[model samples]
Target: MADAASLPRPRRPVEMSGTNQSKRRTSRSWFSRPWASRPRTGGSWHAVAWIAVAACCLPLAGCKTWKKMTTSEKTLAEERTYGATADQRIDELAANAKKAKASSHADQVEFTQGLVKAMLDEHDPRVRCVILETAAEFETAAATAICKGALEDPDERVRMAGCTAWRKRGGAEAVELLAVRYRADPEIDVRLRALRELGDLGDREAVPVLATALEDSDPAVQYRAVGALKKVSGRDLGDDVNKWREWAADPDGSTAEWTIAEGFRQLF
Candidate 1:
């Protein structure tokens, strides 16, 4: 222990005179002043950000929403609160569908039912498109039913998706579905998409659909039909609709277009 007198004294805090304080405040900017000397605030700004984040009012339990939506639905579901948007719900559905392959039969059935419900209840054209696309992953009859219904959906966007879904579920049936869409859709855009998918099919059945599209009233439709014919028929008619129509009128009469791959395939 040291002697008391040998111990160093604690210094008192400095006090400034009114004139000195005024001079110090005037000399320095608000931000330049020592942090301790600045005025203290409770940070109302922090609360403002929090309030903004929580401002979105959530709906009642029975109200329509994409995520965990009510089972009893007649009209399209409405937009949801934060973290529960229609897009987010669709993404979640797609993700869960990926895992559903490992799930039990009951779970798969439940998931499919929920997804189909979402498809029927969703009013957003983009959301409906996603639902139609999601349905393509499952080979269930219910899923197929919704996808078929999309072709006749009031929204052309959904109808366009219906064309794509059928293309993914390819076969003679897919060709037939696309052909129907091309022949009957009121919207020209949907008809164009149908022709595009039909060409992608590369099936013999699509040739007739493409040929019929060549005679459509819309020149754009006819032009698109010519492009599809080039792929489905594997022959370039020089983009002339008339020449393609002539060939389509008698497809078996024309020679096969030669390609390196086709030659090799023929050899094998």
Candidate 2:
């Protein structure tokens, strides 16, 4: 009491007991525990798991939303929505050509023909083929013109379809168009189809072209020309190119004999 500074400061509040010290350590550990080391309740962890799952799925949902639509899908969507533009209408018709029939409404036919005419020069070959096919059903002057133009299509399948449609809508003009395609088309199958259609047309103007096809490098072409010649001219030269050439040289000479022979053969 005489020297207060040296009195040991009243034993520093009696220095905590061992049991109290353990209690103090436990209380501090509760407050200072790492967040990851803490135990979680079922409801809290379930909500956190769902949040993580939603976060992972968000990007996938965004990817689906950002994907570009396909051409057929776009066309179908346009079909379901009304007030389509002229180009869109044309695309719809072309895309649905397989399911569509020749429209019985004259006004509809005329309108579609006008649209098809406008799309004739489109870069897509599929569009051109569908247009030509639909046009053929109308039997209109514009259809004939479009079919004629299709004979020169860069695609062989389009050329074949055009030729078939032209033959179905036959006239002098159609026969003439087929004759040109038969003689000038670089594709052998197209030439053969043209020749066959010409024979089906039963036009005499195709004889000279058929005779030329007799000497084609492709034996199939040569044989097809033989069959077409037989149908058109009633001559059965039996695949002999030389004999066909001889007959072609003077086609007018043996008409009477050939016609009589054809009549007799038909009788049998």
Candidate 3:
């Protein structure tokens, strides 16, 4: 062998061609990119340090408790918490209501609390409409507030939903609420919803409102009022508007004149 000083070092590897050259260029470009091996200058390293710290912290950031096994605990704690968007919140409330249907009474109360919280926090009219329906799931005072408050809600859609909610929860109170909504609500569709619900309720107490609706300028309102008056009064004197108007004009006096099945009830 030649002397060590006289021996030529092996030449650097020859430049590659075609696919190998392309791959090498790509690899070099990637590794030599701006963020790769970035020089520590001024706040640049501070940013990198924060980025590294963030990367290390990301998995653990959800845990403010810092207690072990609390990730699952925190998840359980937010079971009733509404989601960020209106659609997500609606889905969450719907799921909670479905769960509450089979859950124990206490669990249902908890669901109602979440529901009321969502309702109070919600600003979207569409979400408020959903809240009116969800609130019908429980009879809690908070839930009732959500349902009843919807009748007075600024959104017409929510007020309409409130009418439907009370219709499902039929009673003297439901009749009273529907009657009041029919009279007091300004939106024609909402008023129509109230009138329709009152008709379904079939309570005699709704007669006054239904009769008043008969005179409304909106022909739709007058038509609904006639149908509601028929159901509520338990009289089927045909769909003649004039006859119904006369009876509305003097309900007690016209009762005997328009008597049909009601007379049978009295006879029995």
RMSD of 3: 12.7
Better of 1 and 2 by TM-score: 1
- Candidate with best TM-score: 1
Query: What TM-score would each prediction reach against the true structure?
Result: 0.63, 0.61, 0.62
Q: What's the candidate order when arranged by decreasing TM-score?
A: 1, 3, 2
Best by lDDT: 3
After superposition, which runs of candidate 3 have C-alpha atoms over 4 Å from their true positions? Answer: 1-83, 249-268
lDDT of 1 by residue, 10-88 (tens): 9997999999997787557446767555534424555677777666444433333444645432223333223356766
Q: What are the Cα lDDT values of the candidates? A: 0.79, 0.73, 0.80
TM-score computed on alpha carbons, candidate 3: 0.62
Worst 10 residues of 3 by lDDT: 34-43
In candidate 3, position 169 carries an lDDT of 88
Question: Can you write out model 2's per-residue Cα lDDT over 1-268, one digit (the tens) per residue?
Answer: 4787666554546678999997787668656887554435544787899999999999999768646777776667766785455576566776554344444556555655674555554666766677777778765556667777788788998899888987888888877788788878888888889888877876767778777887788888888877877777765666677777777667877632555466568879
Extract clashing residue pairs from model 1: none
